[model samples]
Target: MAKITYIENGGTEHHVDVPTGLSVMDGARRFTIPGIDGDCGGACACATCHVYVEGGWAERLPPMEEIEHDMLDFAFDVKENSRLSCQIKIDDGLDGLIVRTPPRQY
Candidate 1:
């Protein structure tokens, strides 16, 4: 499992141990983290799982795919670090990854 930190827009943080092979969205749902609704159930079909990769983790994550990129267009307050949580799969390499949720998801 990898330790992932999810920070809310208001500064609340949730640290969770996400099992390998699961998406970040899955971890959030498992832990009941707020701000990530994951309406598409990890299908990358919606923008409800939007998150901002913090620190250098954004560069460390795999390149964003076309589907996720397009989906993000529907998210609120998108930034350069913006990403769909469903597109981020957990692995040993992603240990200590930090992500911040937007103020709201649309």
Candidate 2:
């Protein structure tokens, strides 16, 4: 399992142990992390699961696909580090990943 840290906009952090091979959004949703709604159910159709990979983690993640990139544009508070959690598949390399959620989901 990998350890994922979800930091809310107000600075609250939720740590979860996620099984490898699952999507980051699934882990957040399973743990009930407040900021990631995952409205599209990991289909890459919605931006509600938007989050930002803190610091160097962004470089470690795989490049976003065109669909994910387009959906991210609809997310609130998009930034250089922004990503759709649904698009990130968890693995051994992603252990201890930290992602920060935006203040708003819309």
Candidate 3:
């Protein structure tokens, strides 16, 4: 399992042990982390699972696909490191991954 830290808008942080082969959204759900709605589950259909991956960590994740990029248009506060948590797969290599939740979703 990987230890992923999710920081909420108010700086509240949640650290969860996310299992490999699951999406980052799933990890948030497991811990009931606020701000990660995951409205479309892990299908990447909704932008509700949006998150901002911390700098340095974004480079380690896979390049965003066209669908993910398009979906991000519906997310609030989109940044250079913005990503759909549903599109992020947890793995041992991401043991200390850190992500930030937006203030709100569109």
User: Best by lDDT, which number?
Assistant: 1
lDDT for each candidate structure: 0.95, 0.92, 0.93
Off by over 4 Å in 3: none
Over the stretch 1-106, how does candidate 3's per-residue lDDT look in tens digits?
A: 8999999999998888999999999999988999999988889888999999994899999999999999999999899999999999988999999999999976
User: What RMSD does each model have against the real structure?
Assistant: 0.6, 0.7, 0.8
Model 2 misplacement above 4 A: none
lDDT of 2 by residue, 1-106 (tens): 8999999989999989999989989999898889999887888888999999995899999999989888887899899999999999999999889999998897
Superposed by TM-score, candidate 1 places the C-alpha of residue 31 at a distance from the truth, in angstroms, of 0.3
User: Per-residue alpha-carbon lDDT of model 1 for 71-94, expressed as tens digits?
Assistant: 988999999999999999999999
Clash count for candidate 1 is 0
| Candidate 1, residue 82: how far the Cα is off, in Å | 0.2
| Model 1: per-residue Cα lDDT at residue 17 | 95
Supply the global lDDT for candidate 1. 0.95
Model 2, residue 17: C-alpha shift (Å): 0.7
